[model samples]
Target chain A: MNAGHRSESVPNASRLRIAVLAGGVGGAKFVRGLRQVAPEATISVITNTGDDLWLAGVRVCPDLDSIMYALAGVNDAERGWGRAGESERVSAELAAYGAGWPWFTLGDLDLGTHLARTSWLREGATLTEATARLAARWDLGVSLLPMSDDPVETHVVTEQGTMHFEEWWVRHRAALPALAFEQVGADRARPTPSVLGALASADAVLLAPSNPVVSIGTILGVPGLRDAVVSSSARIVGVSPIIGGAAVRGMAAQCLAAVDVDVSAAAVARHYGARVDGGLLDGWLVDTVDSAVVPELDSEGMRAVARPLYLSSLEQSAAIARDALAVALG
Target chain B: MNAGHRSESVPNASRLRIAVLAGGVGGAKFVRGLRQVAPEATISVITNTGDDLWLAGVRVCPDLDSIMYALAGVNDAERGWGRAGESERVSAELAAYGAGWPWFTLGDLDLGTHLARTSWLREGATLTEATARLAARWDLGVSLLPMSDDPVETHVVTEQGTMHFEEWWVRHRAALPALAFEQVGADRARPTPSVLGALASADAVLLAPSNPVVSIGTILGVPGLRDAVVSSSARIVGVSPIIGGAAVRGMAAQCLAAVDVDVSAAAVARHYGARVDGGLLDGWLVDTVDSAVVPELDSEGMRAVARPLYLSSLEQSAAIARDALAVALG
Candidate 1:
């Protein structure tokens, strides 16, 4: 798996054993591009379940669901999140009970996935099994996996009380000034067997355009995973979540600032820092808006490619993916 | 706390310290009636939670919710269950995932109660605390209490296998031939403190027309409670669940048969047996349909009176309560 470019294990190089780390909406959109470009690849999405929480007793895995909905072709295009043809009656009722967590509008249709996952988890099934079950239900061809089966919560430490990632993001609308980020229980949570296998056997690895601090950060925070990826020979490329100076979605800028990192694509690449300084990634995909940072990336001995990353449709996203992969392979 | 049929310690004979042991539909109906007739009475309903189950990770206490909705004046009278203005959108979603049992329709609004209860339970709150929280939300006047805070499931030994009560009632639609009934965990379950206090302090205790085998029997099966009721100084009156040869609601006749009892009002009284015989009841109210059973009840040294037992409406139910209370006082 350690070629520092693309491993030649993918079926015809047309079908790559591609593993992607992702969070919610932006990550999901990038994944949609990945799927469109590499339709024949055995894509394995390692979704961050750090955003997962028991909301009104249902296990709501926001990132996992977003990936699933996107891959299954059922994501709501207009709302930019959740399943298509969704209803929020359950959420409305939940709100009426003064459980007014307004930012995370749990669509009634989306609730089915949550209810199934929660039920199975309660029935002694691990989160891995629950994710598999949900994926099976969606019939999404690609393998979708949670980073771990164990409880690993992302908590944002703010001037206020250290709150859960969901509370920080959804309930508070990510309004609180984040001081730091901690993946609670991640020290004890090992990556699931499939996650390790997917990474090990991958032709290439892509980091979706998710928030670096709480999203992809939580995934990498899993003990031993960073070292495994650092040692792997596969090409590692990440699409920048930051465009110019602002985040594509969520509070990535705030997250970056909380971690004392500059809010720029170059800074994000530097924060990842070649995973032991040239040990994690061979390439980084930055948006056209960050074309100025490409020279700096090359100076750091990492290949940085500028792309028109404003994903307007599946076709545009596929074109971006093709160009990014071509640059990474070269 | 004892007087003739009223307790002097209760301080209000007109405003009775009325304690009721209840289950679902039938019990909830009787509670609605009690609410109407004795609006000023301190009504404490000790509801059976044995019928409670975790469906799709939501804690659904059928008996508790029935009593709650009935007391709140928002029960679906026609279906004899669930909230009056309920919607089954959530259930349809559950069905879509094939997660539902296909028997019970857990309406979205009704599901809010379950979700809240389950969430509370997951947070380490006892069933008693959760029940109090739910009741507080509905602003119910009557003090609704679960029979015990501990886990107690109503299990039915049927020809196929021992199934959960809901599985038996809903999945099979009571079509399976029940061979026996077991109050699982009843041996270890202790009555909630409020239940014991209500029994100890109550002037008159009413066993509403709920199924004796599963409903009232489950409460009686809880180790110390039946003995407490038997020994209490209060007048214990039981309204016949079996009006004639059939139950007014539910398959009470079927339940009685599972416990090897006949399907008559006389049979139901005999099942409660001479606690009525031993002067536990100063009064026994039978439906006019079973006026023939009154002679038998009178011969058993119990004061037997006939009244209309069909709870067709809240007003009619109040009339039944008035007559039953009058019989107890007589």
Candidate 2:
């Protein structure tokens, strides 16, 4: 769809209340692009907190910090995470003292966010409230919400042992083959009120190009969150993290293999399944290289569109965001 | 007495099981010098923990760290506190996040120690065990023991309101007139077993040139610590922090005034009182500039000696330590 047609079909394009489900780096990048595509739209992000962990007594919410820093224009674009012009003196010191994961470097600036969050949390603020307090520091141009107020850590079961997802991903570099992924505490985890409200009132919902199993999958795993998204009247569109037959970033292929899923755009779409068949996705966005999967998605009762999904720059990301929004509108 | 005669009187001086009561910078410097003077002595330092507090969820034992870093040869000599080559990136970030006292800068390397201490404490280790664990990282020749394993935060009662001792000292620079200093939790805080053992079997006990009202006073306030020192068979000698009528460093003068004590070497020695008169000091060493007070201290039933007490260099500090040890031997 063209811009003119999109504006005509989506009457209040500038005022559209868009909600996004996101993970860390990829999710943050996609959300940044979405913000550029619809500058005036009310964007609410329900970010996955499964990757959150306490390091050196400081609560570190990787996904939440990534999104906040990206939107605040301080994210290290080159490293693709943490604050720009960051220093690791604290991390090095922590390592010297044998505190925190030596492999997982927490930048000085990034630690500031964790300390702030931990302080608030200790002062009796829930995770959601602490996130809101952290986000309030910058004019993020969108509302950031955690998937749940309660703790829900993602633990990857491997041949060695059940390790934290971060320990598996960062420390071991995911070299250890995972047996399964467990969202510890998710059974009792409930979506925050803001998350439910955003889903219930959103004009459209977009799933960023985050890891399907650990990111978006974890958000959906939050007891009531998936049901809310499924029941919302808004059309839900998902952008594939995989292009061709491999993950666009990180170790999504390893994650997919652990879940016994093929590392392909078609497999990911099918993993989300179809909203018509008691699943989540109304539309699935795939890269042009995976255009061949459109027919299979359509047969599965989900619309599939192919586009240049690689977000190398803001322009490219905005273009992809426009495509996802177009699919949601359709 | 001359050094040669003093050495004759104190046989096997190098092997003396000397225990020193200490606070932060001044105390650390004195302890470091004492180690240089008697490298083979079984030195046990009972460090003050009243200044210890939780900052950004990390336990910060200022006095213990100062002595540890000093003895480990990693202390910032110029600053007389914290680690050498330290960065304030984390502190700046913490300030930006509004997580800790803006006035008190926690160096990156110092923060690592806090992280380690906090981690150990969380894992059910007492402050003594945590200190031991932290000290194990470096070859600190002396055994460092916190005055008490239990928490004993010194809260300064100021006209404005009660504030943490650190806030009163670092933030206000002791400009806020303190009505009194309260060693909160000291009533239940017990000196660790090691502390008691060190005192009981000590050949000699030397008091570091630290604040008499807060540093040394707070340690003595720990329920049984003062009694242990009083009852110990070993001779107890104190090095006055006051030279002439002023503190050698920091706000000792202000602290002395708060307690309604004269800011003089004799007054402080008298404040500790004579061990014969139910006080804690057997002998007192004062700066040569305060020699006028020696006769008065002798009249008060406490042996007094005058020496050059300024520790501007290691040599000077070593000489001062020699004098203090001579007083203990006498």
Question: What DockQ do the predictions score, one after another?
Answer: 0.51, 0.65
lDDT of 1 by residue, B84-141 (tens): 7777877876776777576778888788778777877888889888888878767576
Candidate 1 collision pairs: A1-A233, A1-A234, A2-A232, A2-A233, A3-A233, A4-A233, B274-B277
Q: Any residue pairs clashing in model 2, and if so which?
A: none
Docking level of model 2: medium
lDDT of 1 by residue, A132-245 (tens): 877876767678889989888999998988988888887787889999888889978999899999989887888878888888888888997776666566778888888887
